[model samples]
Target: MCPTSPSASIFGINTVHRMSLQSALIGFLISRMLPTPLTPQQIIVVQTTAVATGTMPLAAGFVGILPALGLLSEERDGTPPIHLTWLSAVGWSCSVAFFGVFLSPPLRKQVIIEEQLAFPSGTATAQLISVLHKLPPPDTSIRSRRGYLHLDTEDDSAEPTGRSPSSPQPIDTETDADINEREFVQHEGWHALTYSFLASSIMTLIAYFFPILFSIPLFGNYLAKEWLWTFTPSLSYVGQGIIMGFPTAVSMNLGMLVGWAVLSPLSKSQGWAPGAVGDMTNGARGWILWTSLAIMCADSVVSLFPVVYEYFSDLYRAQILRRGDSSSKEDHEVETEDRLVPYTWVTAGLLISIFVGTILVWVVFGNEGIKPWATVLGFILGGMLSVLGVRALGETDLNPVSGLGKISQLFFAWIQPGNVVANIIAGGVAEAGAQQAGDLMQDLKTGHLCKASPRAQFLGQMIGSSVSILVTATAYSLYTRAYPIPGPSFPAPTAYVWLSLARLLRDGQLPEKSGVFMFAFAIVFGLVSASKTYAARRQSPIAKWIPSGVAFAIGFLNTPSFSLARLVGGIMDYVYRTRYARDGNDISLIVVASGFVLGEGVISVVSLVLRTFGVGVISCWGCGHGLCGGCPAV
Candidate 1:
């Protein structure tokens, strides 16, 4: 999973309940009428659950699985039975759990304690949770039972700390001093979130009806028509860009500049792709995707070399040297035993999940399933990659799971030789493992900051991940049935990225010298990526100028219009921080961005429902129904 963007966490939960008056009203009435509203501790559990459920079957998992199963394209099967997909999802979920639970615990001392690497999103979330709990209850209501929602009773002094009178109470000096400040921020943040959500929701509905409102071609019509270089008038990308940061948004735009403005025209002129320039599959789009994937894979693998060495070196000392010395254990190595997830639990969980996953793989894929030895190899590689992923997440707040999958695919291509089924399964195992492990580690970082128990968090993670298996599988089945995925509305670009790698390894289908060029460029970019990381760690001034290979790869995958919207959003972030924000900690920006993403996302879901019912879509006229045709269904 990527960093816990606003869309991924708080806003997503808020909007779902807010979308229906019945749900919202019921929640409201319950808060007011019930004996007690949610406590701060309960609120933390809710947030933790949201984070937990967001992992396991990520969007990438869905994207990769669809193409891997050969269900997204015209030449492949339409869809499979939900039972089959659900069972497969079960296996996938278990594989992720194996790494998340069994593999993640050992590294807690190194990743979270010693190195103290800033998992930025996790840190942000921890801060947000702290601020939220600090907000005072309503001034006047039925009675303030305990938490934020309920009315204040006449005697406010009754159980002031929500504790029994006999219990010792610690003074909340921080809360008392910051009450006014917290109140101001709370009210403003709520207004921003609410107003932006309403505005975006209304605008989205309007855009769907008007159609022309979806497109806003700031540049000339010719460029918009020819190269998809237009402004997409939507808050989704803008919100994503704000959370993703300006540097990345700029990097993606640079990729668009190279891929669309430079490479597309170059490929067309040179007859490299040998098809219409605009064709997604056979033309410049397909051609550029390979290069993007190559660069990203290279960058990801190269960046992990140092971390991998350190991880293994630590293991060698603990396993080999420590055995001889017995007293060589470092101070940082010791953690509170009671706070830790028990080793017995980890061992048992791993054994059970691994057994289940292995059995399911053989059953699901039949003859094409990887052999038992190959399955073991996949797990080993997956565990190795999870370490790299956790390290990357610690440092940069990005998990290169897609690259991890491609790496596994490449390895399997050589091992299994032309077995795409084995290739996808192995790759999926590694990708899911890395993703789950990294996400869990990020959450652990949050848990550590919040002083939450690791054992409890792990249990919560297990339950949430288990539930996610069904939820994600059901969602994938429903969405596939509801709409023609890999089509305009659900492009599944990452799925194509996965498929492209599989085909390349399977069929050796590469344009003349393109593969050679891509590989060569990948190596150079990989070096540049490593150098950028080094410089950033050293606080070198030149680090900011060095483009992120991952971001550029994202740009290569996305259209120019999408990149343009992200660029606009990044600029907005810069502007807002410079002008309106206090020390760039203003809560309004986060709430607004969250609202933008949630509102648009909720509307998209609504549109998907409409599509399922065979409601016709309106065509945009402004930019020829989305940059000279290619408008997604509304």
Candidate 2:
């Protein structure tokens, strides 16, 4: 669930790490596939529908299948220490996906409707939907800002069609190719997005063969002389920044500053951190992983106190204080299904997830490796952290999943110190939960603006997650079976984190005892965060500049240069948005951004598929090197 934490409309989709962008493109292609060329409005509905079913589940599998496979893949005692059927893995993943669907409604209320988080991608999708449908405005104004999302006013009579409910778009048989293309640009702004997709894909293809030649700075080269160690100049990072916007971008950068720019250099100078010899990147990684983990774990606990207290306090006010709202019912009414998915289905899904999850954990990890109570705690944290993840997404469109997952991993470690598999699976659930929730909301936001059927969106989510479980599991299994892992073909980067941790724990290698000081520092930062929460509750203006604890933690998840790229993108977006946002019709820039992102994703997908199937996407004449470490038998 690689939610881009995006904002710059079109480009954000490609910046996302998962297949969400594919859903958008696929939907667009579906329109093309139709005998009659549909307008962008119709295509958006198609896109939203496809995304609901496609993106969520595919990304969600990392949580479900990866953990079981991770444990199964581990060669303990000269063979896999634990055993479980592939069906069990699929079942575990499905159950988690279902839990996501179950949990969405409550979260939608608490985070979206109540808290009014930005949900940048969601907001952009809504705008995009408007453009697609060419909806008429209700004399609306966008109070665009950083942090929170505000739908300044609700046009009670407004629909996705941008027309009164009684009106309908005229059906036309006009079929001039030039007219169609111009109309596509006018309505959906697809042309710019298409061009970007083509350009980036071409560059990606060129980079694949000639890593040295046509070497783009962002994707290929480091700054000056390998200064930052894997300082990738990627469009994805830039797109991410643009999508996340100013508040999130800046806060994340602050975190990056602390991790790489500040801490890494400080640690290196003191000669305290390892990886002193090889590259600067190593120091950055070591410090951030160590310090950020401590900070995030503490922050996770401290940040919750305010939210929980606020929730309860609200309940008390509603009950004892008897507080009441003055807004009219018409102002709040929505055309879509009030409850997107049925409570019955959610209950079933929750039960199944817990039941299957319990069986899977016990079967795979065994009694000694982990306790049942630990697994329960994992699911609980996963559930709770998912809310936090979704809330952050709504506010900043920035996914805090990696940071959240790391915290979950640490929590599991505390519960059962030595079991690496337990840590990984626990982290997986948290990550997956975040993905499912975020994916649903992203789709729903588009659906809401497009006035697509909520029930259809819900159904799409369920079906997509289910299908993805099977597809991801099968494909993963095939790839793993074909390639001896830590080899070409099946890199399984996610698996590496757990495997490495398991090895260290199994061999009794934990972080140094001095690392406890980091915990102390984390506590200080967390308490400060708690203080900020109190100030925010009082509506103090100063709280706005406090820098989000969650967003800061998110910064440590990626490298410094990547964070820098996002900041740059955010700045550019701000510049363009300031000029164009007034019209409410200025979507060409958004379209351009989208094109670039989609191109990157589509080309990457093609390249990945080709690589997996033992084919090279291109050939380099001077250098015989390919991404596959030169051609080998598949």
TM-scores, in order shown?
0.81, 0.69
lDDT of 1 by residue, 267-369 (tens): 8778887776556566887778878888888878777766667667767866887679888645543348897888887788777766776666666666545
lDDT of 2 at 543: 60
What is the Cα root-mean-square deviation between model 1 and the actual structure? 9.5
Q: What is the lDDT of residue 505 in candidate 1?
A: 88
Find the 10 residues in a row with the least total lDDT in model 2: 1-10
> Which stretches of model 2 miss by more than 4 angstroms?
1-92, 106-124, 136-150, 153-184, 213-231, 246-258, 276-284, 298-305, 318-340, 360-377, 384-418, 445-451, 474-561, 564-568, 578-585, 613-634
Give residue 475's error in model 1 in angstroms: 2.0
Candidate 2 residue-wise lDDT, 1-634, digit = tens: 0111112121222234223333454455446556886664455445554564454433444423353344444355233544335675566555465666666766765555444455556555555444434443222222232223345435355453222345543445223433443365555655556666677667656655544332223333333123242333446556556655565578778887776666666666666555642121244344455565556556656655544454556567556534355342222325545635566766787777777776666765577555677767766777787776676555435455555666676677777776666666666666666666766776665555555566666666667666767765554444444334423222222343444444444454434432664666587778867776566545466665676665665566454544666677778777887874544334445455555556654555555565577765354442222223233322
Which candidate number has the best TM-score? 1
TM-score of 1: 0.81
Clashing pairs in 1: 143-151, 143-152, 144-151, 144-152
